[model samples]
Target: MKMGMRKPSLKKSISARTKGQLTRRIKRTLNPYYGKRGTGWLHPKKKLYNKAYQKTTFSFWDLFK
Candidate 1:
């Protein structure tokens, strides 16, 4: 398991910040349970993705970057 900050992906960083807003908005609008409780079961892949993302990513507040 990756125990520290993930290797940066230029494409992921740029596109994640720039694109997919509409998709996010649409998902939130269509699903009342979106981003809320029981999402792990409802979307196991998303849950796993989030778990891995959290483990491997860093925040803006991180001094080391």
Candidate 2:
């Protein structure tokens, strides 16, 4: 679990901003459990890691390069 600044990746950041909308739309269309609550149960470990990562890590302006 990374606890401080997140390692930066331009590609990942760019993908996050752009891919979110399209993938969300696709998930909403094709995934039966897209927006349902408690759906994280399907992938508890991944969900837990992401939750921790969000709370514990942050990005620095210079880290992008």
Candidate 3:
């Protein structure tokens, strides 16, 4: 009998990636995991990449949206 490969679950795919991205984002925003807090920190080696610019005026409601 021949067996075929099954497609990945859509729900699992989205949730998995979403959780991973959010986790990394939160970790990087906090201290310890992220080394310093200035220009030198963005030297590629110790840079923290985010979806948007580091500096933004995102209010409490705006963050949820």
Candidate 4:
């Protein structure tokens, strides 16, 4: 067997608690859903949707009445 087919593993010296904390921190910084308006939070498509939501005033009753 060659090392090319083997998967890499972290050092056993690192504790499980440290690994969990690191993963949580990494997720917090890299997540797309946790950012502010100027970050990845807002986009052109979202703005268009918001505009449509605010301006739309259609009523089915008006047409029938």
> Candidate 1 regions off by >4 Å?
41-61
Model 1 steric clash pairs: none
Query: Which candidate leads the pack in lDDT?
Result: 2
Could you give the candidate ranking by lDDT, starting with the highest? 2, 1, 4, 3
Which structure among the candidates has the greatest TM-score?
2
Q: Estimate TM-scores for all models.
A: 0.57, 0.62, 0.28, 0.25
Off by over 4 Å in 3: 1-7, 31-65
Q: If the candidates were sorted by their TM-score against the true structure, best first, what order would they fall in? A: 2, 1, 3, 4
TM-score of 2: 0.62
The Cα RMSD of model 2 versus the native structure comes to 4.1
lDDT of 1 by residue, 30-54 (tens): 9887778765876788879888888
lDDT of 4 by residue, 2-54 (tens): 22222324554355468867876787889855534565335778767655654
**Candidate 1 Cα lDDT to native:** 0.74
Error of 3 at 16 (Å): 2.8
What's the true lDDT of residue 14 in model 4? 57
Name the better of 1 and 4 by lDDT: 1
